[model samples]
Target: MAGSTFVIAGQNAIRRFKPKDHIFETLATHVDQEMLNKPNDLAFDALGNLVFTCPGNSRQEPTGYICALQPDGRVTKIPEHMYFPNGLAFAPFEDALIIAETYRHRLWKGHWNASALKWEDAHPWVEVGGPIGPDGMAFDQAGNLYVAIFDQAQIKQINPQGEIREVYPLSGRRPTNCAFDLSGKHGLIVTEAERGEILSLSVDQPGFPLFRGNNGWK
Candidate 1:
């Protein structure tokens, strides 16, 4: 599905799009009847469940939620009160879900039990400094949690022991997401607020240019 591109909650209300010809097919118009319907990030779980975040109607309206779009085109809410949940990932080697609360600068973790269709074991994973504006997150093999601090122009590494190890500075000011390379020694970072550029850096050489633009991130 790499070639497939979907514009979420657009004016036309399309759900799926194929990029081969840049064709957007409307799968659900007014699909999100419950919320304001602005879609956010999407990621797949280990079981290939297509999970998505939509911080609809601000924090005032009771619309934003973490939802999973089933294979049969059914949408179900997993958890409520996510508060502009931005980034997510299945923890290092566990089934637990790690969510980045964008506005709260906090990390929330929970477990998904299929029978319940709702998340439980909710708790704070980590909370960064004032308005660090946390975003995309990833985990290293060593169990170190790496968070892209949006406004801080840095990446904060949280070790397995719950220690905030080091703040690695970045050339870009607003890093929105991050992912480790296949080798696990480097990272691919993306900035959203600034031109939507990407950067690649090593775990050791935290500061220099390993790559830039889209070419560097992959």
Candidate 2:
């Protein structure tokens, strides 16, 4: 029963939506007019506020920022300045938000407190891919960060203590997003490019595709 809102950087306006009906709510059109135009991924904080990447349109977009949609429908920007920030997650144990920097090939950390919105203690948390673009991310029950790497065509597993534990490469050229099965024994992966299909991989084994689809909405 979560509410919906669409927010971009520099835009104070909030657009709400209903997923079930696939329609916009009353405040669907009001948006911030002063923020950056291009935003990347969308995530949520512990309080359920919407958070997303405001990468703008250039790699030079100064110190990337993450926008939080407040309960009042106002979007607040947190300037983090992590290179091309993408996927994001809150590390409960650390009380901080972990963000993946696509162009920097690393992860950045920020405190979760309300006052942490401004970039102050922001710093690199973990490095990934020797030279690959890290995109979508997810954390396993063990707190292992799984990164969908582009160009390299692999999923990198970074352990809780900041270690490159494993690499799961796919036969497909590019893997976009990923989700673990309830049992944690299998994974479902989405490939943004290549036109048609999701690559399913077994956790026990790596670099193999179990099944694929025709890129259908169904």
Candidate 3:
């Protein structure tokens, strides 16, 4: 997985792609529909377990949940019901996993238990303001969290203390997610879902490099 890219499809499936040869292979399929109706964002824990968010229908109820796919093909649902789990990320120090609850307009944190292979101490990390929902998140080297505000077409920079420090307006509409490029020029790349485009912007800070194990999926 070191040289390959992983992609999540709409039909509850995950795929791996080799860019050099343009070859794609189905990595996992038929993910539990009840627990993972809509797999939104994914991240890896310190132990390399696949953590993903399933933001179920927001109009119905708070049915969304966070799930972890173990290396041995077992799926464990984190014991929490979120309104709309959209984005996911692990702390730079691998201390906690951060989640964005879109409909609730807040970020949540959960600590990992390596021995038990579970998450604990789940709590609210930050309360995002405004009518727009937080969709995706990325961290800078200085531990600043960048959140993509979907409805407002804006991005918010939140400090480690969970305070909004700055907001940047974007030309794209309905921005779905964002990621910072650690290599090359160190720019922020955002996905304009509605417009079907990708936007790149230069930032003052570089992104924190994510830890990748020898297995490569992380």
Number of the top lDDT candidate: 3
Off by over 4 Å in 1: 1-9, 12-22, 25-32, 57-63, 114-116, 181-186, 204-218
Writing each residue's lDDT as its tens digit, candidate 2 over 1-218 gives: 34433433234334556677787544322235664445666655555566677665446565666776554556677764556777777653455667878887788876776544443477788877636577777666566777788777788887778788998877765676675565545564555565456776666422221112212111
Question: What is candidate 1's TM-score against the reference?
Answer: 0.75
lDDT for model 2, please.
0.62
Candidate 3 regions exceeding 4 Å error are 19-23, 30-35, 184-186, 215-218
**lDDT: which is higher, 1 or 2?**
1
**For candidate 3, lDDT tens digit of each residue in 50-71?**
7788776853588787777776
Expressed as tens digits, the lDDT of each residue in 61-179 for candidate 1 is: 44557776654555676777766777776655455777777777788888865444566797887887646567877776666778888888888887766679988888778888887
Give me the displacement of residue 179 in model 3, in angstroms.
0.7
Off by over 4 Å in 2: 2-20, 26-32, 60-63, 114-120, 130-132, 181-186, 204-218
TM-score of each: 0.75, 0.75, 0.87
- Please state the error at residue 83 of candidate 3 in Å: 0.7
Better of 2 and 3 by lDDT: 3
Q: In candidate 2, how many Å is residue 21 off?
A: 3.9
Cα deviation of 104 in candidate 3 (Å)? 1.0
lDDT of 1: 0.64
